[model samples]
Target: MHLPPISLMLLQVLALHTLVFCCQASTFTDQTDKQALLEFQSNLSPNSRVSLASWNESFDLCNWTGVTCARKHKRVSGLNLSGMKLTGVISPSFLTSVSLSHNSFHGSIPPEVGKLFRLQHLNLSNNVLGGGIPLGLSNCSALLNNLEHEIPSELASLSSLVLLSLRRNALTGKLPASFGNLTSLERLDLAYNRMEGEIHEMLFLGGNAFKGQIPSSLANITSIREFDIAACDMTGSIPLSFGRLHNLEILGFSYNSLGSYSSRDLDFLGSLNNCTQLQHLGVGYNRLGGKMPHAISNLPNRLTYLFLGGNFISGSIPHDIGNLESLQTFKVEQSLLTGELPTSLGMLSRLGRLQLQSNMMSGEIPPSLGNLSMIAELLFYLLYPGLDYNMLHGSIPQELMEARSLVSLNVSYNNLTGDLPREVGKLENLIQLYVSHNQLSGHIPQTLGSCLSLEEISLNRNLFEGSIINIRDLRDLKLLDLSNNNLSGSIPGHLVNLSV
Candidate 1:
């Protein structure tokens, strides 16, 4: 078709313009977002291994390292620079998920981080980040850090928060009562902080300076499963209201000043029996005194670890304690406990570590303890089936020698009278044997030399008659005290030349 020259020229120009516009659209990138990232890179210390050399105006930010962008808008969506040895200030950006954990980022978290209204997950954990947590993180579903400073009450606004961990920080001051407003909160860990004052449920504030009674308000959080406030300065009795937490599994309030020698001090044990699922209960290293209530036997049968040690608890350990069929660790050392060792303790098939040391316990060592075939890791490899410092007077139970896991045995300073058990040599794992200051009579058992692992043997001040025999093979022996015994013979040449 014939057309004018002007019309042909106009059509050609229109085609050229369309080509140029499409090229520009294809190369379009969010310059603002790119600039923000560049600014962030500038704040970090230079590292040849993890440089942001690709983050420049010449390239698209979506193609940069540790950065993600939306397909349509090209805005930053995620930034994961974790474990890159990043050392710098974290510049605020409009991101959905930000993870700078396991880095070397230092200094206070900028409050401008709250400006990311779309932020859902933020993790700055395992970093050197310091200062208070920004109040602006209320929109985050998961916020973790090593932040120092009081827990901001503004966090109560984080209704979407499911996990908040600020462990190993210097956070101090009381938790605001507004924390109760966080009904959606599932896990809150503020451990190893300097936090003081009361606390509620879903709290793991162990290794803190928190003092005063465990707040009764904790009973309101019925969904709480694990609660630990150990190694704190908290005083006063455990609240009776704790019984309401029927779902509680692990409860630790150790190393505190929570009780005295009064009966009312341990009444909480009776209340705790209501928690049927209770498993691990550690109230050790406290001022808990008075007779251990028999109700302790009624604690949920699911209990595995029971640490009530380092207290002033007196009187007999309840015979019914054997009812805890699931029991693993039973530690109650350094107390004023009296009465015979309960034979019922042997019924605990899962019993591993049984510590009843430094007490005034009388009577013979229960032979049934040998029935604990499952006993392993005894007292952390220093098993002191302590009948020591007591009036216990009987032969060392041959049954105890059945425990092949026995490492250290301390029957020292007792009124025990008998020949050393020949079966003692069967304990190849025996490291230290302390039967000194006892009325043990009979020639030192030649079988003792079979203990290849023996490092220290304290048979001093006993009626050991015969000269030590065959101990020359114990090259690991460092300390051997057979002094003040009825031994009349030339010292073995090996013993005289021994290093110790």
Candidate 2:
């Protein structure tokens, strides 16, 4: 049906009005976006090492460097001002707040960000940005922050923050105690930050450990602190260039196929002396062999943990082992080390755990060990000094019994002989005493009953004679292997807790 002439005129007028309104709105959005882009460039131009000379009003806003605009309305949709080598403060105002991540942008985040009333998303992650995290960011639902320096207690105010990923950074200082106040936070990552806390326990990689031998070029990354490449199933020697990594901390190469039985297998230890901050070295459970180089003694004095166990290491331990004053746990167990205990070991006043079990070490027990316990009574201390399964001979030194901190004493399967020191009773904390399969011959110390914490008492296959001394007070006793001993008296009735 045909409309009347006046109806047609009304329809035509309405269509023209809609077109003009859309054109005016589009022009406004375009001009606003262009102005915002120009403002952002002006703030960066003076400090930016890269050129933004192309950002000018003479050209279209869409064509300006790192600027993206909507095809329909010609309004800025994105601004990737990354890698501009920007050196000034972050721009306070921007038309879009999405995807400004992984740039070379430097400077403090502007606090004026809270002024963006219409803002929804903001991600300034993976940049050279340093300074306290901006407080205004608490308003966002998610964050991929890249901040350096110490974290401020003020960040606990971001109660609504969900994901805060700040991994692989140089952030230092203790974490603010107030972070527990983040009631709405879901995930928080602060890996690789040099703060005062345990960074990780075991970082098990889901995929194959190595692409191959770790690239020696990685040594060029002198700033790296950790090299925990254990269980990587990799072959070849560690790169000597690793010494160049002056900031290296924990270096782990355990459970791998590194090092031949060659003399130079552990030459890398010499180079590692340069890493003054080195601590917690673990090269255990590998195919590494040969005598430990004297360079091992030259390791950084800062070293606290040295795990050279489960290898084919032979020859006497370096005499200068005491040089590592901060040494805490020395585990060379299950190796082929021989020779007497280095008397200098008493110098490691801070030594806590000495595990030399399962080696070929011989010679009478060192008397200087008494000094370890004496100094321990002052400041540094030790516990669980395992020397089992060796060629260690002569009497159990009376001084060794003074290590009151000893909880477990295992000297089993050795040539150890002589009376069990009555001083053994002084180890009130002693739990398991395994002196079985040795030449030890004497009445089991009646004072052993004083160690109420005693659990497993394995004195079997020794020449211990007369009678089993009173151990009725050992209520926690579990395994009592006294077989093949010459004890003549009947077992006490109260010894019901122990399994024969």
Candidate 1: lDDT of 138?
54
RMSD of each: 10.7, 18.1
lDDT of 1 at 256: 83
User: How well does model 2 score by local distance difference test?
Assistant: 0.71
- Which parts of model 2 have CA positions greater than 4 angstroms off? 1-208, 375-382, 497-500
How displaced is residue 109 in candidate 1, in Å? 1.9
lDDT of each residue in 316-365, candidate 1, tens digit only: 99999899988888888888889998899889877766778788989988
TM-score per prediction, in order, is 0.80, 0.61
Q: Give model 2 RMSD, 1 decimal.
A: 18.1
Best lDDT among the predictions, by candidate number: 1
- What's each prediction's clash count? 0, 0
TM-score result, candidate 2: 0.61
Least lDDT summed over 10 consecutive residues: which range in candidate 1? 1-10
